[model samples]
Target chain A: MTMGFEAGQDAFARAVTDPEAALPPGVTSRRGEADAMRFAVYRNNVTVGLIRALEMRFPVARRLVGEAFFRTLARDYMRHELPASPLLFEYGDSLPAFIEGHEVSESLPYLADVTRVEAAWTRAYHARDAHPLTIAELAAIRPEDLGATRLVAHPSAALVRSAHPAGSIWAAHQSETVTPPRAWQPETVLVARPDMEVTVRILPERDAPFAQALLAGEALDAAAAKALAADATFDFGSALVGLVSLGAFSARTDDEDLPK
Target chain B: MTRFDERETGLPRRSGLGLKPEHYQSINDGEPDVGFFEVHAENYMGAGGPPHRWLETIAAKYPLSLHGVALSIGAAGPLDKAHLARLRTLVERYRPASFSEHLAWSTHDTGFLNDLLPLPYTDETLQRVCDHVDETQQALGCRMLLENPSTYVLFEESTIDEIDFLTAISDRTGCGLLLDVNNVMVSAVNHRLDPYAYLDRFPVERVGEVHLAGYDEAQDGAGDRLLIDAHATEVKDDVFALYEHLLRRAGPLPTLVEWDNDVPAFDVLHAEARRVDGALAAEAARRNARAA
Candidate 1:
């Protein structure tokens, strides 16, 4: 194949950094801007393109950081990390984590949490289509097996725990700009696709502990025990009903591990 | 609303629309009445979605052409792998009748601009282009098409005329030409050269496909007219007139009606594709009658 792994990466770097500094045969380069200034236009255009794509993909995050700050951080992100593939929808999987670690964004401790919520929303929007268990289907499952029958979460189901009102922070930043004071209390987010439309909601602190255990693929008994221990008000009855209604699970199996 | 006549795509040497998402259902719901459907290969890079879904169904019905927008072939650097992988995937899936990209570069030290930016015509650049084309064809595992760009500015350092560069690229790389009639007219007028002069100089025999689309005649803030190939509005009369002129020489080829932004209804796009099919049909009949 003409395209090797190394050449493609190098070419992308050159194209992104200085578009015209190096030229291939038959390609004509723009002239007469005093060499240094010539590349400035292309450099600006490259940064602008990446920033705009990031803005489109993460509107809520951009709104949180405002235009100037977002552009600066987006520029840094693009320079350090190019997209692994052209599938832009899948681009920014690590952005939330990246933002949390950046020293410049350290003051805005909640910024990373807001970004995490936004990423979850994006994932839900393009998640694979699965047959959501109908209300009738759920009603058929006997209540006796409910405790033993593990519920499958929808492919888009994402439960995130944070120390900020990340859902409202992301939601409020949707249309207009605002810099509200971060809540001293922690918040949890539940992103799901109940219907064709994806929705994100804030979870009560009492329900937050269940997220890690479930997402970690722990057994049903262990997860419920963790959830119960974390919050006295963590009602298993309401949580089970909610999980089925939201199509949070793909399929269910008993907590008992089978022989390999 | 209909597939083009069977005879329109005879040799596949014609101008065609770069298929858009809006026209997918209308074009594929029936058969396309035009020569071919050329799409930005990058758009359909998705694993499975509207781009692939519609194109898959349509490619089986008509001759499809793959055009790469993010190749950044004209940049001083080498080809991009991820982009090429996607292109290779599209080519493997569609087995398209033709594949092509511009003499434009849109990548820099930063990342992708995702727009067709201009390149200067220099020997060093030409060698780079040939290498890229050769590499692209090898990666794609297919013969390629190279489209001339409708540039906004000229380089004082450019030694080769656009046509000569295209011809050289073809000779050395064994790639074909996707002659955009409107681009020829626009660039000739913008740079103060005769449009017909370009037609005469280009080796039309190597042209595997043709593209005819609308151009917005707007000047820069200084009022120096810039012919941007917007492809938004109707195919301009001058451009259509030029198409008629080019087709008379280049012979019948696959043509498309490209409208990316502010896409009108599906019927409007079908009508445009039908219009091209009608013209090509008339040309073919005229030749047949002459032979008779």
Candidate 2:
């Protein structure tokens, strides 16, 4: 009974992996001259369906590479990695890293960084949701012990600091929502669900340390120290004002009040 | 209260919409008319947050259904236990009305394809599918419904037809069918098989629910028509016509309109559900007169 089962799977892999292979006995494919043609349809549908799902998750990568080459890249990628789950949307978590080390993509070195930005952007969108502490809650924090206070950032807040100017590449993909970077420099991209919509903002060099420190769960004072070192001219007061406005912090808990 | 209980096997009302994370708010605000909601079970495999919160709120008022896309019952390999454990967790959270998966397989040892893949109808595959279904029914502890998939090609593999394979599984495990009308039409047209004939030959009595969706038609490299099940477009005209044919024959069962990508506003999906209601109502009226 299981003989046909194993035979069928082997036949399926061959039929999908290489379209030119002959169909198994008793297997009839209708599209081409023989069963091979018909099975080709299955191979095409599965391949195209998966590639399209990858394209949907990583549209910027697709746009950056253009249509034809991207399809080739996607096909090659599929050859190596098939889906382990049925949820199509969440399929390609490893493609960003894959592109980083892929030999064929040497020409587009920036592609991997750009893909990372996009991945972080998606992570922020689908991450666990948490309520940002309101202005009233912040007001409750006593100024006397503000430095020792630890703030929990919203779960969706993700910061990606890349050497490549990936922030600009990502921004350019948004059709009507264009914010052309004034200059191409290593930029820190902060992704957050400000309101209902997910927004990505390019961070200034001087202020990135603070955001990075805050992401590491550092207290406000320590994060500020790192921000100051990155740029002496860094304005802690102004940065905090902006970060708070973006719904970046979930809540601030006093150090002494921390659970044992 | 216990997070999830077995009583969740309760069915969503006659009119229910596909639950999407994007539409979490409107669902929470409570659309009493919406009755209940259903989700692709694989989406909520991870722990914590919105998927769980929203499911709890919606499940509280409206009945829920845990529809799945990745069970791969027809695969040559053994059933995936990790996948089943994730589903069991979801069952605890959502307490869905009906739990179901496709009568197809897309997973290989490497990973999942996400699409409901096609299977050859053969004696060997038949035994494999039944065994998988029996295991799944036992693991989940809820009666299951096996959904048919839309296919672009045919297999010349030896023996069995679509209905026969499904009936054999149904006979063995008492699993019901989730007949996707659009799939029938799409597969029938792609393979040049007759839609009416396929429908006429199916085991309608075993159909527990039905599905209606849209398709995009384009010419492949060789000029052969490829009907892609995009689900982004509105339900095709012919598909709706076929759906009416099904409701007339099967009576009023819980039906769904799946529009996954390029999703419009809440009103758009609501209007689509209302259209199904209109068709079902018309069919009942006609059936009543014939009885008279």
Best by TM-score: 2
- Give me candidate 2's TM-score against the actual structure: 0.80
Q: For residue B205, what is the lDDT in candidate 2?
A: 80
What are the interface RMSDs of all the models? 7.8, 4.4
* Candidate 1 DockQ vs. native: 0.16
lDDT of each residue in B1-292, candidate 2, tens digit only: 1111323125542656787877888767756476457788876764444566667777787777788888889898998898887887777666677888898887876566555667778877888888888888777766788987787656666478787888888887878888888889888877778888888888888776778788978654456665767778778998998877777777777777888778888888888888887887787788899999
Every model: Cα RMSD to truth: 7.0, 4.9
For each prediction in turn, the share of the native Cα contacts (below 8 Å between chains A and B) that it retains comes to: 0.10, 0.44
Q: Candidate 1: where are CA atoms >4 Å away? A: A1-118, A121-207, A236-260, B1-36, B47-63, B217-223
How good is the docking of model 2, by CAPRI class?
acceptable
By DockQ thresholds, what CAPRI class is model 1? incorrect
Q: Where is the poorest 10-residue window by lDDT in model 2 chain B? A: B1-10
